[model samples]
Target chain A: MFITSIGYYIPDGRITNSDITEILVEDNKEHFSKEDIEFLTYSCTRKFEFLGIETRSCCSEENGDHFASMAEKAARKAIDQAGIPPEEIDCLIFSGVTNPFREPSFAIMLAHRLGIKTGDFFDINDTCNGFMKSIDVAGLYLKSEKYRHILVATCESPYDLKNTLKLDIHIENTDQIDNRLSGLIVGTGAAAMILSSDGGKGRITHYGEQRTSNDWDASMLTLPGTAVPGAKYGDTITGFWSDGRLISSSLIREMPEFILRKLSEWGLDAQSIDLFIHHQLGNNVTFALMDKLNADHQKAPVNTFKQFGNMATVNIPVNLAIADEQGLIKKGDSILLLSSSCGLSYALLHIVW
Target chain B: MTFDEFKLMVSDGLGIDDTLLNRDLSFRDDLGIDSLSVINFLVKIEHKFKFKFDVEHIWAMKNLGEIYDTFTEALNNK
Candidate 1:
């Protein structure tokens, strides 16, 4: 299957380092010491600089923006760009970490909002790998010839007060500071892609072998699904933890080998791929991957994390949309989407656009 | 590579003075070599030794000495 259209929506509330620090201090005043607050604020600045994330976008709660609404906006843009009747989309997949509820998949809700009459609808959660995995699933359905068109969409709002402020910020050690701050690195954004079986410019040629290591537990958001007995209403989805250093470093160490092996198997080299669209983990991870592959720096869009922060699954699609708008992609250009998720899942998908 | 040789590579790879290096120095705390840099240095070691170190072990090795011991053990096994 080939991608017919792509679109994204980044919320308007531009959040800066100072804003994050203010929230951290204001929310945890009675819980942390003066020194702890000072140290964490300093650490936030340092980490943001090291991660190369300058600013992030946050949705306004007053505007009633939630995951479903954001996904609808992004999906509508994708459908509009597809230039096809909404009825043509035979499948809708909502792939994102942040969801409005545990039941009634966002896809079911989105289909109604988008005016899609008949289609298969569901949700997939693979953390940052959600979108890529959704596309992978869509390709399988399209290959079966049962589905003519599919829309895969994602909307992540990690910066919501309920999600961010609820983090267990009672830091007992400096190491915990780094781990907790990773959750705060994410901003709010939505992205969508429309894939079709018919002729299109972008085609998924191969989905590489996914390498899953035990390191996924190194970073996680405790969602409601893992709720325990006697849990309070919001006990789940309260804690967001991550070893940002371990995750980024491990990806740097592991991705080169995994990708190179896949490239050799696919009978291609790194230099031949026109664009290497990486999951916008950070500048460190993206640039490090490029350096290890010994590929041209210009072949990859390296500044999305710095410009947009980490939108989790939304990073790649938003980057793809930006690249398209910037005239970076051309017909028949080989593209590789390198995705690494919190589950320690790694995948490299080859596409010709 | 000997501990001295590893120190030299660490100094060269991370752009620090060789004299400042020590076996007991915490890679993150003492040398200020962030986790990303430590892994990058380990990647260089992997290239030098022609073998792959366990990715998970990279985070568990807290000190320069621990990293050296693990590398030595892995290289000897290889």
Candidate 2:
């Protein structure tokens, strides 16, 4: 399936480093002394620099923005760009890292918003690689001619307090600061794409995925499934519960192998790729990946994590939008969309624009 | 989980080969896993074993043997 059009929506409310620090100090006054607060504030500033993030969008809670609303906004833009009406979409896939609830999938909710009555619905939760998996699945359906247009969309609101664990400032170990701050790294964003067999100028030439489930538990998230019947009232989500060192080590070791194997088996070389769209994990991990692959850093640009933080599965599409808006990628450019997630899931999609 | 199963899980979760996993081996030196992973692993162990380790109790363990022994101690205490 070819990517006919891409569209994105990041909430207008921005959260800066200072705002986060203030929240930390204000929320945990009993646990931290004045000096400790200063130290923690300084630490938060360093974290911003270390993670390569300056600001991130938070969905306006006061405006009553939820996943369905965000997805509707993004999907409409993509449909408009593709010049295809909502009814023409053969399939609706709510593909991403975060699905707020198991029932009433984003596809159904989004379809309702678009005033479309019918389409095959699908969902994937491979975390960060989720968007690519959706495209891969959409491609398979397209090959049969049974499906012409598939709308794949993602809206992650990790910053939504209900979806993530509140910051804990009670710990005495200063070293735990980085781990505690990780929850803040996630931001809210949405992106949608119209993919068709015979659609836009961008052609999805190759798609691949791999896993090292040998250690999938290195990261974990416990959502209260707030909307689920079994969930109790006053429940909440416990998120960003991850082992970063283990994850970074494995990603550092495995990502190169993944990249090399894909390039070799496909008879393609790294130099041929014009743009590399990767999971916005962080600057250290991402840049380390580029350096190890011996890729030109300029070509594999990493400007999104700084601007939007880690929007999880939406990172790739958001990066693509940034590249398009910045004139970094244009028609005829070869693009590589590589994704890595908490479950040790990985997917790579090659696009010829 | 048995001690062997726990060791295997550690190997599996850390992406360390089975050959490198042994009670005598230090989790830090032999596996090259950082302190954060050790804490994360200990937490996982608690979940699987249905037991909780005191903060200081988890802090002092070093090699795989100590990890196994500490849990055994917890069992004996219970």
Candidate 3:
């Protein structure tokens, strides 16, 4: 199976770190340290301008159409670059943490927008690791010889109030600096990639996963839309609290070793890989993972944390597209994509360019 | 800092118009500055002032006045 094309999009609005900090001070007066602001600012994936809406354009509650619109733009670009027609697509997948509606998969909406009716479309909610999982599933379908072309799209407007609510809570409780600091670096964005069986541009070599559960810690980071009973009420009614540092500590402890083991299984060392495209969770986690894998810092894809922030699922593909645009990857380069999600799911994929 | 000096710093840092710098304008709102712009400004600030402002502190600043104040404070402290 070949990885044909990739595309990404971010909303027009821009929100700086200072913008968020100014808003946070209205609810909580506690002063945040420079480290705290850097971590939190880096966590946001998008910077939305004031559009006179309840939430910014990047927020989940702003509009479902925006997500669909951006997803369609990226999908169209990817298909065009791959030199494939929309109707030729056999399968389409939309995976991410933020979805416009609970019912009717976003993939179906994307497929409709792209005018691709001859394909099977679905959505995946694997959070950070969704893209890698979708790649594995698409690869299997490609190997079946029944499908000729597949489109995998992942989008997350993490800046949305629905999604940002979790981040907002973590940021508001700045006095609990340790926990809030950890979750503050993930930003919001969207990405799409086309997969084909006809030997296109890029190819997937191997995919692996390692899972560990911290069910007790599952409540550490809860989105506002969750069905958790007590949380059904408003934020004032039910005190919003999450220990992000606790979650990151667990992830940091488990992920590096898991990724290293997966790479070793393929008999490939860090030096063999040309680029490392991680989840874009944060600068800290990225550096920590690099140190563990003994990977060179220069070889890693540009981390948008300092710019766009953490964009959850869109992080990987956005970086990939930017690298591609900058000619960062050559014909035979090996790219390693890894992600660890909230369910304690860790996934890794090796791509041969 | 003098207005001319501030305009030079922001222009050299953000690659935007030096004339855009108004004493009353808010950087976060009026100028529509984002994180990337903030980072670019920080890099230039470090080079020009020979000091690094705390990124988190910089992240917490809202307007141009606040940024100017922070930079001055950092320079003074340095």
DockQ of each: 0.11, 0.09, 0.03
Q: Tell me how large the interface RMSD of candidate 2 is.
A: 9.9
Per-residue lDDT of B1-78 in model 3, one digit per residue for the tens? Answer: 766788787877667698878667765446645333455446545655667666446544667777788777877799
lDDT of each: 0.78, 0.74, 0.67
How do the predictions measure up, each by TM-score?
A: 0.79, 0.75, 0.69
lDDT tens readout by residue for model 2, A96-186: 5667667877678787787667988767787777788888889989999999999999988876644344534334444455555556677
Best by lDDT: 1
Candidates 1 and 2, the one with greater TM-score: 1
Which has the better DockQ: candidate 1, or candidate 3?
Answer: 1
Candidate 2 residue lDDT tens string, B8-36: 77787667787767888876446656544
* Order of the predicted models by TM-score, top scorer first: 1, 2, 3
The native-contact fractions of the candidates, in order shown, are 0.18, 0.18, 0.00
Please provide, for model 1 over A173-272, each residue's C-alpha lDDT reduced to its tens digit, 9 standing for 90 to 100. Answer: 5445666777667878999999999876688888875656566466766643465344322334346767766676677777788999999999988989
The numbered model that scores best in DockQ is 1
Q: Positional deviation of B23 in candidate 3, in angstroms?
A: 47
The weakest ten consecutive residues by lDDT in model 3 chain B span B32-41
Q: Rank the candidates by DockQ, best first.
A: 1, 2, 3
